[model samples]
Target chain A: MNSEETITKASVEDIDRIIHEPARLNIMLYLYVVENADFVYLLHKTGLSKGNLSVHLQKLEANGYLEIMKEFLNRKPHTMVRLTQRGRDAFTAYRESLLNILQ
Target chain B: MKDPLLEQVQNDVATEQQYRDGIPRIAAGFFLIITMLLQMNGNGNTFVMFVPLMPTIIESLRKRFTYPRIGYAKVRDRGSMRKYSLWAVGILLLVGAAVFFINQVSPGTIPQENHQPLLLMWATAIIVVLLGIMVFTSRSNIMATLNAMGVVAIANRFFVLGLHRDALYVVMIAFGAFLLLSGLYSLLSFVKEYPVLTDE
Candidate 1:
């Protein structure tokens, strides 16, 4: 196989499919820093719409990468998300795997 | 196809900075006031000791103000925290040594009745260390010019402009007060601009 084909295969193979998706990847990466972030905070960071953000966040939660808490603040709904340990490990692995690409 | 992850990271970094924008000025101003208050009480090495906690105070204020508006993130990782811990230890050691030297060798390294220079040294050191943290950890430059102004204000205390130490402290204190007020104004503006849309 040509070097280009080989490179593409290696890159694609190493990428973490869960985190490789653009939106989930962004969500995981951003939450990795803070203990937890609110819905608005994440929304601002990702610039995603209410519906799209909810979908991506649900996906991450289903994957066990995200722990979401829904609370009522002043009779209004509030959502906070934390990156799980599993998620952090996945991200670390994802980052390590992407070293070649980043460089 | 653009790196949305990198973009989020960048955007969050900016948000963190915006959240912390005016804090350095407030901290510097706080230091100045504390310096004056300590001096008024005859200093006695007690007041100077709390200077190290400036970083902690800055963090506390940031959390207090930022939380009411936007939420927080653990800005530093474990590795980064360890690095800061080592630096904190090193700084404590350095300050301890300086304090010990001053107590034991006073009238040798530092002459009596010239306290402004001593306060000047503390002010500069604290601001530089605080500014370093800002530049490195949070990437906040909002206080860059104000930090410089603080140093200049304290250093102005040493000039031969015919100002007495008391007079100089007053001028320095004025600038410090103004800087802090500016910080408060910025903080209030931030609160207004970004009304808490979420209970989080």
Candidate 2:
């Protein structure tokens, strides 16, 4: 394929490094639909074990893609997540970039 | 303390998953609509009416539509298709036998005026079951399936009822309107998350 075609197609490397992992994508997508979701809901939605999801969520949180709020629900520790404005813009751009490459 | 790269990855995965989840629904919906239309025509034995058509539809869909883009690429295996066919055949036989036994056991229970509508309803039920099967086993798009269901429901209302052609047209138009609205809602939501890119 020509350079143009290559640009249009999201590289395997890009997909592997960025978009292909199972857990993080699920979390981002779920948050995109629901304004905010609790840690428990994320656990259910992603089907990721709590530890696994937590690790991924922390990675995302560190990356500035998400805001994690720690609060008390029923007097128990609860964590809620929401996409930051930057995260939302990045996600939209990333999606279009991927589609352009893939298409 | 946010990682843009990780966040981007998460969004991509979610979008792909949503599309993946929608596949079976789309397939089932298409089958449902086709079977409904066939049933509405009031021809052919119900026992095996859709049997020959299943493979044809799958093949045609695969050939005509690009894979992955329009959700056609997901049907990589024939195993689910075979299972679907077998299940359809078995259910059809069982229904046929039941209908036959019912008529034999109580000949007067089925009034002459109600026979056609009852048959239509039975056919619709069978199609719905088949749709459920597709949803579970196949990788079809959900939006496509919903659209197909809408089409079948509208067609069933018109043809099976033997309504005036004009009335049928009106019903079909209304059905189309509903489908358009629902489709737009789904598209808008999807688009909101993943906006269309334009080269300026």
- Say which candidate scores most in TM-score: 1
Going through the candidates in order, the fraction of native interface contacts each one reproduces equals: 0.38, 0.00
Interface RMS for model 1: 3.4
Measured with C-alpha atoms, the lDDT of residue B121 in candidate 1 is 46
* Top candidate, metric lDDT: 1
Q: Per-residue lDDT for A2-103 in model 1, tens only?
A: 997788679869788989989888888788766677887777667777788899989889999989999886677878889999998898888876876666
lDDT of 2 by residue, A1-103 (tens): 8987665554543553333466787777667654565676566456676688888888888888899888874565767778888777666666666666666
Q: Evaluated against the true chain A, what TM-score does chain A of model 1 have?
A: 0.85
> Which 10 successive residues of model 2 chain B have the least lDDT summed?
B67-76
**Candidate 2 Cα misplacement greater than 4 A, ranges:** A6-20, B1-200
TM-score of each predicted structure versus truth: 0.64, 0.33
Model 2 lDDT at residue A12: 42
Candidate 2 vs. true structure, TM-score: 0.33
Cα lDDT for residue B81, candidate 1: 31
